[model samples]
Target: MADLRTTNPDPASPYPLDPADVTPAGPPRAGAGVGLAVPGRATGERGFVPPASLADFAGLARAALPAEVWDFVAGGSGTETTLAANRAALDRVAVLPRMLAGVDTPSTEAALPGGRFALPVAVAPMAYQKLLHPDGEVGLAAAARAAGVPYVASTLASTPVEDIAAVGGTVWFQLYWLRDRGMVADLVGRALAAGCAGLMVTVDVPVLGRRLRDVRNGFALPPHVAAANLPGGRDDLAHQGTPGVSAVAVHTGAVFAPALSWADLAWLRERTPVPLLVKGILDPRDAVRAAELGVDAVVVSNHGGRQLDGAPGSAAVLPEVVAAVGERCAVLLDSGVRGGTDVLRALALGAAGVLVGRPLLWALAAGGRAGAEAALALLAAELRDALILSGCADPAAARELRTLIGG
Candidate 1:
């Protein structure tokens, strides 16, 4: 039986990154990249060893990315109060472990409306990944496919849907609700045609957040990076205007649909063929409404605390929404999910699964495909270990464990 115990890794030591963690260690599948024990530094890279701690990837990403790009990826809106709260809320939930129960090799598997997960973790979408590494979404998708997890490709991805799909395996497309319905339908059509199993429509960000870091850093995409999926290309999202104002905010004002309503979402539901998930829901009432609209899932998110500084972390509100609609539709979460214990905590709180954001981006930036793949492997390992210690065999048992909320 596999040992279901894990300890925090030394920040300096290379994690026990086995080839089977994210790569096909035994036999190569079509385009799975060098399946080996080498965790840090993908093929043809130099002097980078994968770190054990997911938090350590941040320094590597910072060193690899330009200041503005880092700010764009890492910074939140306003004072980032909600950003801090996101992590703090996760820390507040204390898991009461059940010892001496016959549990070994605990299962980390999860079932979502999208598909089966080897573990209840999904890659949350972030924009302009090309800036992180040349592999971008293609590399990330390959890693996720190898890990048996879902990858949510951003609408603002530097790679096109067709190119992303060409990497093989079904993916989930994240849509931003662009102003034109024709364009919206077109993007959805392309995503569906490209074999995306799910459509994650982000209902937050009627306007982009006031990320002071981006403003201070004068963040702008390099000339080479452009929205690959958008026809005719978009100069707006790729460029920065003025030094102090948020370029993203300006872009959202001109490009996104602020007046969007539940009716508009209902319209989208009617047209979309794959499983549809609403990506931002803080209120249980709103969750109920989305379930009533027959959405396959409602992702409990505060846009990773990027849109509203005042809002609470998604985990803080997870249970209420789950209670309201857990039976009606799947409930997922995003924002401030750092490690497997966090995933365990979320499952215990009634989240069907948790979407990880910044950590994987850091991995992609630091180690490209290898780093991204290792991120999921690390989390899955941790979740499995946690389940064994807690005497839970699977995600359903995880939901029934004793939980104490507080410091």
Candidate 2:
């Protein structure tokens, strides 16, 4: 495979980049860019240069973090078949560019239940962000504020909900249905009090999938990175005194409701007046059912390939889910989204929007607050180029663009 690093022949030029120099490698770095960072940009005190692409961010994050932490962030369930499939599906999609349309500007704004966003992207919920950086969710929230996108706070967030809310951005709360109803109620109330715009109930992770990397690395949350949102600020520990088992695994078993059903969703809907979204719906039937149950939206996800090892890629299943419920409600996607062109393809394939996960985490690990901001900026910039090239003058019009499969 070709080297995926983003380099510059002459670091001064900002425009009219060489096409040969900017092209990605093979399947591994399919959506990554090369040498896209402009020279003489602001740098962090540590001389941290912003990454040029999502792949660059991933490399930096891997180099900076501990082996266990990197594995936890990057690893997928079982053989990681679904993880690879997500990228493979995206790689197969080819945009059919239109020429001489006289389109000068491409608008990226997209509408959600509460408001319109600058792009059709939102920060997907991820657990234990503090493990990656000191700034944690607070840093991510600030970055999301700067990027004009929503930040979905995970149920297992390292920072407290109130602190993240204080950042004053478009925030959504992602809930992992807990066994205790009272605990669930408390979390819901806290999120609402903190000014969250919507509630995304994650239904896929009834039990944590067996992640081989975490098992081999013996990964567990450090003492500092506790799930602050949980009652008593508990961490995911296997047991108070267990020596061998992973704490996260133990926590997953104790908190998540294994028997959760659609009826429980109705119960949740009754409790929160905010827009309720059912996340991790890969099946068209589930998408239809979620909409029928009064969900404001349904997120088409395979839990970022972290659950169900053999499941189809989120992108592979997106078109069917969109067809099932596009008229009934919004159909957002998440899994292996790398950059703007991938976003464009997803829109063309019928996703209303997408939720980005690992790339932001990689950014946080690479350069903390500044890295996260730079990552979002890079994606937005790329999206603009993609829209102009794909013959869409506006992001909303991306839905009408044609896609050639197996490109």
Candidate 3:
């Protein structure tokens, strides 16, 4: 296993998603993903053409996976208004580039509350990966390791978090904030013991958003898949639904603590020694409160439009959140992050880094580990191009970029 966390297990490094690299480097940036093997295409792999773009991966994955599975992956909460808004919000942000600033070979490396990564992006936590492809989270983590990025293993990951951590890269565990504090505490202990670099507490889903498509499709995990980390290997996450009701919403309403609040967040902050990040902050006040409570970071997200059908896109709310807590804690953004330009937009808006969601899954479903690597490489290359063109020499410099909304 990569000793990135082993070497610096107590990663309470100040959140540095700011205009400068002001955050303290907790320890020598652990080998910068040294143990993860970089992948190269082999000639013997038959008929597999690497994806030229994320959309290409989406196309391939759509055709390859079952329609029900695709719906489960692609569908969102009622009316999907928030889902479409996520992409539209990203589309509205335009970067105004500088002339003759002589920036070239812009370094994509960025530091977050967890660790520095090859790019300013990490994989967003999603669950039950085996349903997407047989290789699942393990394969995806290997690819992320190879690309020098962090993988936020989901609470509902098909494989155990310990196994995912063993894949030899920086792994952060995404906790779902279950009603049982003891159960939650045990999960945290397991992740820390397994050498996870950080613990991100997802605070959005007090109850699962009612997804209409899942209701119409009546989706559920196949017999072979289960949430491996839960005691007794129980898979309680509501992955799908029935004709009239969203099973996920119903189960979530019960299994998860609908009463989860700021006090609960405070409890979590005290429970774990690792860098604690609070995910699902759209309001500036919430961001401020989290920062005040000693949170190392906050992920501004709408759960990839999977929850809260009417909520604004993460990009739309990012600037305000950063303005609220950018100086106090790291602010990360997710939702509708389809390309490198989006990453640039997030940074320009004051996010320390961005968490990529569905595109990586599309790549994984399209071509397994190699596909995921290809996706990250494509994003990194595109981010470098955007930075160079805009004369931003490093990821942090993008913070000073001038942007116009609705351009």
Candidate 4:
């Protein structure tokens, strides 16, 4: 049996990057470069440099993106309190580093539901990635495969899941679990047929959250980017459109579903044999409930703070959730995770892995596939450094390096 463990690299040690960790180790690939040889550039020469950390990526993305785009992608609900708090909470957790141990090559491998990944990080499911670049999810999937990480497929993906899987391997499906059961079934069937490794059913969103920035920007779904799972029809506007809101009137019915419940999990479980994961779980009690429901795993998230303005940061709630679940199933986390240190922090609290949210979109928008690949590479480097500096020889060692700051 494969070891369900993580190996940390030493920062101070003489450990150098293996060939797989570098850029030139693999073949040269282009991303949604829009007719150019490079992504986000007219020439083969890509202009932007992939940031080394979350902060670096944020600065680069801010400089590269428009105000409206950034707001729609990065902004949270109402006051954005939860959005800011996510980072703040992550900053509160400190790593108890280890001393000089004979360390050579450090690995950031993680054991996921279907298989393992090179790193404990994945790209979170986001909608309308084509808005960020022409290639959209296809480019992202390619980058994930190249970087040896998994790409979670969003129901709202501009690129069809089948097409994405064709371009890249090991795709996971994320469902909004709409009011139409048949639509959900069809998506599951498609995912299974496409060889998806797992199913991530997002449970928090019954209706769209109060994304003030999206409303202010008059964010409407672009007509070209349609949900491949749903049929094309305008008469079903009642299901797709927000009843009172005109600004969000054009979004697909796929975005909101008020009929979701735990009962529906039974129906969902029967649809696919793939490992089922419940996303948007923040409460420890809910984590316990999810494990009881026989979910293969649970992701501690607040929907990137895009939903529920006052919710605690996912990192702040991770320990409690972990305690509740008690290793019954895998525990994954998202929201405000930007670097390897964040991965280490989440792992210290018992998260099996972490997901990258808006920063990835920024990388895609700024540089396309190459940019996204570079972004993943930088994160892997950071994770390796974090493991080394923290004196964690492997993933199991992270359990020992954890230090609770308060009661």
Candidate 5:
């Protein structure tokens, strides 16, 4: 058996999606107040061909968004040593391939307790996607559905959870447990009502990190674009509620609790019925602890290298976490997964799946929903090719195939 979770144990299923799921929603419309105007270009004029690699997709998306928004989504904490290291770690793994294994087709499906994914990838939950494109999470949800992958929605999503769920894809919700238990329960209730298949509570940020870029940019939400669900007025740039931000010259009074402990996780666990996956796990000891707590899964992430400086990249720690977690719970990976080859490398290292960060926002900035879909479609194709070329006919084979070299 494969060490990590996969949608299909069978290696012969060539097509990932069932035929009925192929219909994609039309291009995304901008959300209210984004002031984004789509030019008068026909759908055909938008072009159907994507670049041969994700690097090219990234280039196109980079050219689309503004400098501040890009920096906000892309920048990491404290010199971004961890940020660059995430990609660099992936560069070190070697995927050893086999010759004449007779693998003509490859299967990418991996079954989960909730359902299966078209590929060993899911779009990680992110905040303020509308900042990248007006469609935001909704656009991403539709694209994931079309591509037969799952979409995990952020608690701070600009688009409401119900709206994103209505796109008819397998959906999960990520939570930032508030200091108030009532608020946490309310958020979990909201997600359950929205038809979320699972709940992932991110435990790493007992308090939001000291994000230097947000401080440097005075990254307050513009009056027109505040988080609608936040207690303070979503549109007020000057409103400071919990966490104090001197950078904006406005102290938001809201302060995320900095005293969270493992006992607090058990407290939060009592309120939700959905399967709970813990994000922000990098330590092997924590991974084992989470499994002992009977958590459904663990996402081995460094918050995309945005939280701590000089922390080990997700790649460096994935194998250890997977080993620690063992078969007790599923182990998913995130942080700087750039392409199909990266996906392959991660799976070989024993990741059940990988999450794509920043690049989706880049795609959204470049072309909204359509651009995001194009990027997903491109990766699916590339993953398929990688599976075949490596002589691994399925995700299970990736666990044993070791002849492929990494970048």
Candidate 6:
């Protein structure tokens, strides 16, 4: 491994430390503007100026999208208590930086069962991406490929699995455990045939949570945007609902399997050739159980706080889950991860990597493929800065740093 640590340049140190010579890197790539460019139309042909930060990207997305589509992308379950908690919990963790330790060019590489990613970040599965952009999951997979990260394709994706897989990245399939076993098997076969590297079984949403925003918006898939992976085609995947009910609710009630249990893992395990990971785990016991059941990994998530309104934040429960299963299998995290520092915090708390949602969609909505690429690049740059400033030379070193909670 390369030594990323460099001599510190701070001269006011009691101990012998090199003088501070760190200078801010120049402006980010063409599309990614960090205090260098403003958000607007692309400057030249085949180029665009992305927002300076994820928040800015979100603002652009909100401005670009219709009210209903924005609500579907940003809203959480009823009351959004879990959503608030997720941000609050992450905010409570204070990063304790170390000085005099030489660190530069910090490596953010993360190893998954499929391959090693350039950063400890992956795109989480989100439904109906076509609602955000015409490229949908295919665009996301292309962005992931460009970023050297993984893309977890959702069962509810607007594009078919084969098309997404054809984008040529580390693709992971997220199964919702539909009510019909035949449909489930067929989907799995499609994903496998499409060359997905792993299977992420989402076990949290036995029933869709009551999303008030969607209800108020009378959210339903537009006639054109449909789950393209289903057997009966787009018509079968069309979500039907009334004014008070969300299309998500109606879809789940019709297809989501409520009787799924641990015993069913065997059936899935036997059907797939790739590794299996259970997503939406918060409890330490569940993490342990996943390990016992031969799961390759477990994501400490609360469905991005969209499934259960009162559930604990994924960040708050990450340490406990890590303590329980750190030795058995890889522990990834999702929900409430907003930036590079958040990614570092999760790694310090024992997450192998972090799955990012919402923000990527925001970027995609804002500028299509170029915007999404800029978003990933911005985070990669931020992670590098965070690692160097925190006196860590790599993700492994960041993980070894001491963390303070409730600060």
Question: Which 10 consecutive residues of model 6 have the lowest summed lDDT?
Answer: 1-10
What's the CA error at residue 339 for candidate 4, in Å?
Answer: 0.7
Worst lDDT 10-window in candidate 3: 15-24
Model 6, runs deviating above 4 Å: 1-39, 233-241
lDDT by residue for model 6 over 284-345, one digit each (tens)?
A: 99899989888889999998778988899899999999999868999998997777888989
Off by over 4 Å in 3: 1-48, 236-247
Better model by TM-score: candidate 3 vs candidate 4? 3
What RMSD does each model have against the real structure?
8.9, 8.1, 12.0, 10.5, 10.8, 11.3
Q: How close is candidate 3 to the true structure, as a TM-score?
A: 0.86
Compared with the true structure, the alpha-carbon lDDT of candidate 5 equals: 0.70
lDDT by residue (147-235, candidate 3, tens digit) is 89889998888899999999988999999978888888889999999999999989988888886656665666666677788876345
Question: lDDT for each of the candidates?
Answer: 0.76, 0.78, 0.76, 0.70, 0.70, 0.77
List model 2 lDDT by residue over 1-407, tens digit each.
12323222123523232121123322232222111111122374434466666655666664455555666777777777787788888888887888887887889999866779999999999998888888789988899999999999999998999899899989999999898889898999999999999999999999998876566555677777788898774553632424445568778888888988989998998888988888999989999998998898899899877899889988888889989886888989898888898899999999889999988987887667778888898999889999999888877789888877787
Worst 10 residues of 4 by lDDT: 1-10
Error of 5 at 99 (Å): 1.9
Off by over 4 Å in 2: 1-42, 45-48, 236-244
Give all TM-scores, in the order shown: 0.87, 0.88, 0.86, 0.84, 0.84, 0.88
Residue-pair clashes, model 5: 25
Clashing pairs in 1: none
Per-residue error (Å), model 6, residue 328 = 0.5
User: Hey, what RMSD does candidate 1 come out at?
Assistant: 8.9
